[model samples]
Target: METSSVLIINLLVWFLLLANVLSFSTFEKLVLPPSVTGPESASFDRGGEGPYVTVADGRILKWKGPSVGFVDFAYTSPNRTKIACDGTNDLKFGPICGRPLALSFNYKTSDLYITDAFFGLLVVGFNGGLATQLSGGYKYLSGIDVESYTGNVYMTDASLTSDSTGRLLKYDPRTQRVTVLLSGLSGGGGPAVSSSRNYVLVPDYINKKIQRYWLQGPKKETTEVFLTDCGSPKTIKRAVNDGEFWVAVEKQVQQQPVLTEPQGLRVNGSAVVLQTVPLTQFSDMTLAVVQESNDALYVGSSYTDFVGVYKN
Candidate 1:
């Protein structure tokens, strides 16, 4: 049978069966928890330490010391305050962001670029103004990050194909062109670009690895492994102060754990430890971390719908 004919027949049967059913579940029917409440004035330490704040609601989780900051898609820290941008979950654009999962700041432009799961990308002014969309009709964009050298944007298309593959795209505002930089990356998502614009660190979600690519050289020779079998880091962001990057691995155990939960890794000063500081109740779909002017840290999680905070 022709593909269209087969699809029509399947649709007819599905509609008939669904019509006979009393209640049906839909994407909208899926229940998302009420947003977590955040703190009015969350506290943090001076040097790389603090508690984690749930971005959407701003629920503060205190610790013996400080925690790491990871803000997903919420308002930025307005004057060193970590704010979450709870994006829209409309179906037409909702599935694209899955949770509006990108966080990046352009110091030169003083603008924040966020990739809402429902909308492609939203550009908001740092000084507070209208937030606008940057792209449209993308299957899924996991996270957004900027290149320090040229102030260009890079993001991930988690999957829109049969192979469960993903690709990287460059957003050139001058030309308003979104071009695919690399493709066929198995489960590629969460991009972190180097300050000098030399390399990009990407998390291979399905492959359980972190890969780096040279942006200047030929595309074919660019892909290289930064860390393989590195738990299952879902999202990554470059540290603001240092050139090192941080990755949020979903979980340590696939089904059941024998040891610690998966943690974030900071590539800095020849020191990398599987952090014990828990950032999310569930492994956040993306790790949205940024450095604040006050030297604190903020992180975000899609599953929890809150931004986690830590003192930097």
Candidate 2:
């Protein structure tokens, strides 16, 4: 009996080892250019041709597959010159170099809308050259989303100071007017419009909460708390599935003042979390964006030079 029990235990151990190997096999690291550090957010074009990302050096790059890798796609500011901004992450040069933080595609017009930390809101056409600035008075722009049904762009200003001076703004393409939707947001992250275009979700990084703002329903213009106690949630992106979203959460060690783990949560419109995917392998990095598509997970970090891809 003892011999038989030992054999069964060995088999179980081997099975567990195989499972771990399989999980690791599904993960792949895609390295970017040495200068392209901090890919804060990513988006795909209408033709599904890109995982186009905004980097720290004030440029947007588009992935052209393994053979070609990422190529220059757009720049936020007209003043940004290759010699001045190509490889630097200096905050002092942000106004001149243009650090783009968030981006979303307007499917109808094939235009990409961007939110730059120093340049305010901007957009570039499908051809992708110099981005045109639409607004210019934000202290720190962070998140952006475009409503496909109506070319309305929604974005968040992270903060004016360490205090709660963050706000949500909407820019209408039809009228060329920008309106303040909500004020007093405490360090906002990403804003994602619902698939139905009736609502939008914005994350509050300082308060660790996600807020839902209504756009077209009876609750139009009303805002409410969607999820609370989310661990330093950064960017929120719509999932491939209807009514679902992927949120990046930076889990920090309580005593160390450092991020220990990063996680992605799949949540529904009702604010119920469906699944929590562990992204701890990112190693000492805070994941700024978690997007899922085609049975694969695309992870972005604000301090790393590479994007992690995991087969789901």
Among these predicted structures, which one has the highest lDDT? 2
Give lDDT for model 2.
0.85
Task: Tell me how many clashing residue pairs each candidate has.
Answer: 44, 0
Span of 10 residues, lowest total lDDT, candidate 1:
22-31
**lDDT, residue 57, candidate 2:** 85
- Count backbone overlaps in model 2: 0
TM-score of 1: 0.62
Which residue runs of candidate 2 sit more than 4 Å off their true CA positions? Answer: 1-25, 256-259
| Candidate 1 residue runs with Cα over 4 Å from true position | 1-99, 160-163, 217-221, 254-260, 268-296
- What are the lDDT scores of the predictions, listed in order? 0.53, 0.85
lDDT of 2 by residue, 158-268 (tens): 664557888888999889898999887887688899998889998888888899999988999999999996687888999989999999987666555664678888899
| Local accuracy of candidate 1 as per-residue lDDT tens digits, 1-312 | 699999999999898666533221111111123443322112233232333232232122323331323332233222122232243333342232233345566767666676644557667654433347678777777667776457689998866443646888889888888988777766645788876567787777767777777787565436777787667666776655566766766555545544335455656423254233344333524444432323334444444444444542
